[model samples]
Target: MRYPIETLGEALAEGIVTGHPAMPQFELTPPEINDLLSYLKSLE
Candidate 1:
């Protein structure tokens, strides 16, 4: 099953705050996060 789009965005937001294994920690505005999530959802 696929994960919810909002969940993905939340995870991404958290990862950016906590830092992911291969990703550097960075801050993103809410709109930016929404844009990213939109793009990711397109791929799904």
Candidate 2:
């Protein structure tokens, strides 16, 4: 990961919105975000 997991989590919590054609904006609950972060961390 290029950034710290916390930073990634924060971004996810805030909802990722971009002007790009392919990317979609989305947000998750704190627990859902934490679960996702844990899964990503497990890959390492």
| TM-score on alpha carbons, each prediction | 0.53, 0.72
Evaluated against the true structure, the overall lDDT of model 1 is 0.71
**Candidate 2 minimal-lDDT segment of 10 residues:** 12-21
Model 2, residue 42: what's the lDDT? 98
Q: Give the TM-score of candidate 1.
A: 0.53
lDDT (Cα atoms) of all candidates against the true structure: 0.71, 0.82
**TM-score of candidate 2 relative to the true fold:** 0.72
Residue 44's lDDT within candidate 2 is 83
Q: Compose the digit string of candidate 2's lDDT tens values, residues 1-44.
A: 26588698888877666768797667799999999999999998
Off by over 4 Å in 2: none
